[model samples]
Target chain A: MTASGGPAVRLVTGTVLDADGAPVAGASVHLADGPVPLPDIAALTGPDGRFSFPVGADGVYTVACRTADGRGARAAVAVGPAGAPPVELRPG
Target chain B: MTNGPHTAVSNQPVEITAPAAEQAVFEGPSEGAQGGSPAAFTSDGLEQVAGHTRALSESVPAEAWTAPSAPLPDIGEASFGPPDMLETVHGPDDRVQITDTAAYPWRVNASLLITAADNSQWIGTGWFIGPHTLVTAGHVVHIKHSGVPGRDGWVKSIQVMPGRNGTFLPFGAVTSTNFRSVTGWTADGDENFDYGAIVIPTELGAVTGWFGFGSWPDADLLKTSVNISGYPGDQPPGTQWYDGRGVSSVNPLKVFYDIDTAGGQSGSAVYRIHNGGRYGIAVHAYGGLTTNSGTRITKAVFDNLVLWKA
Candidate 1:
């Protein structure tokens, strides 16, 4: 099925960390199509500072993270339409 | 001296007939009696409103309508840092400042206003949704500390300056004839229900050509692009700004986006273009550094909006 016709099965994973390299729990993580404005998937980092997204029709995707104190960071990863391996994100 | 034309006063009162399911949204004393009752208008307030009206009458021609623009850009795959992260002593560049008003005549329908009540003035943004009805954030019109019954914190009055570009008032300013809000916001302080409306004199919207509002499934809405224009406090007060981006996430009650907004932008219309017409789908309210949120126009909210427009 086409990407829009069904739920996204491609998985992207990452870890969120503070400037000190410590896990930043409760930070918001967003995954969107490459450089495009707006994220298609959003989630909060868990206690272990891990987050994941199931994006559809992924070519290149941007992963962004923002902590409660307003610190933010982002990175870009390329994914296949079928799926991709895990990725890590560190927000300064 | 460019105030358009002096049309006779319609003085037509809008009859709010929200359905029973939506009545709970408007619970509380009538809007006029919320905050210590309406305060007596000061001469300065009256004069300001009059000046605003005259200016609008001269500036907004009767047939003023913004022609449609190109469809929003497609969301492509690329990586960019959050706007806040890019900030340095020099300042942030997330918001694209709009300098040409003629290119965005519809911006005239968005207004920045001060809610004067309890001897304090609070600023917020609002947009025209009908010939006389304006939609804005609920908190813009009323403030309640506890959200308790009979604890209404309604403001005395709201002064709206439409098409305010810095010191210039292209369409003019006016005060609300009435105000309305959802009980979830006024009584419960629920962010999910932070929506409200103001009733203005009919002539203003007639000249501005208000936007239509709608409610669509979140899935379908996610596929479209969204744009918002409003007065941001951080910028020069009264100057409108515009930004458009695809929705980041959406739920039944809220639409999330990365569009940069500031405090004064609450109540700005979060709208999209469909079939060459602009339709509001949410009422912009909250601004987080990473994500800005708006109260989604659900079926219940859409029904209430229809009644308010009627």
Candidate 2:
């Protein structure tokens, strides 16, 4: 994978929303059965329920999320050098 | 410290072998265990290949060959928190998570779900050193200067899960209260002394295998390729990640590197791979924007590991 400033790397950012289409707060988002990464403790969504992961190469990666109340969702996407669009996760 | 670039990979296993007598292993930290002689520092850490037990049962078909089905009790030490939990990002985060953790090497690293003395939960990494002993960062086991009243001693408990990929725990999890650290770390809270060990009641390591650690000369170490793999909090919960890079710097007490790492990766092994052997050169702890470092394996630290693993 590319380093922090390596031109080959790009960010894949998105948000976690509920069935109501409102941004969910305090959601735990992570790679779907993949390598571990940053964020000192847990990979948590921000106040806006947004989460992000780094895409180093051209491939498909799955991003999954869950809330304390048991709502969960996941998205599998293909990324390229130009980077992919943001993903939306909605757990029933 | 932050890493610029790294040849990051998943938890892919290479050959694991005994130290093939690298004369370098018997070098450096030229001091005796108790102020005796440089000979004291020349000892090699205990390493085992997977499928073999470090301590076997007396009967043929020893229990060591099989895992203990009975659950382990949760034993923990004093308070724990992030007064100094450093996970620096130098650039874009390029960590690769490992889901194929049912194999060698990767299985040695553990996901440390820590229950601090204050009852707050935290996460960190640790690795097997012996059949029943796991090595980790001192702060992971004991909190210091956390600024919380009555929350700076032995943590309450730690659930050690080896080869944990998300929720797929191939080697089932075990909780423990028993731990070991030096006075320098526990009393002084010194960064240089930030290393410790966890002793589980079972010999789970015999199944996962363990790394051999040693203290080599400062000159012999520069630019050596090193590997670091552990559970980072930023990735999926309980997922293991990995990266390999060259040693960036070294002091009498630490070995610095450009390997990409983050928080919760604290206590991961900074190991050197040689002729099929993995030797822990340091116990990873502090992180910087440009370079992350670990408590170097020296005479004092090696002696502690010797005693703790026994």
Best by DockQ: 2
DockQ of every candidate structure: 0.03, 0.09
Worst 10 residues of 1 chain B by lDDT: B1-10
TM-scores vs. true structure, each candidate = 0.55, 0.60
lDDT of 2 by residue, B133-198 (tens): 888987777776553455467777889998899879988999988877765666656566778888
Angstrom error of the Cα, residue A18, model 1: value is 36
Could you give the C-alpha RMSD of every candidate to the true structure, in order shown?
16.9, 17.3
**Per-candidate count of clashing residue pairs (backbone under 3 Å):** 15, 23
Q: What's the true lDDT of residue B277 in model 1?
A: 57
**lDDT of all the models against the reference?**
0.56, 0.62
Angstrom error at residue B268, model 2: 0.5
TM-score of predicted chain B versus true chain B for each candidate? 0.69, 0.72
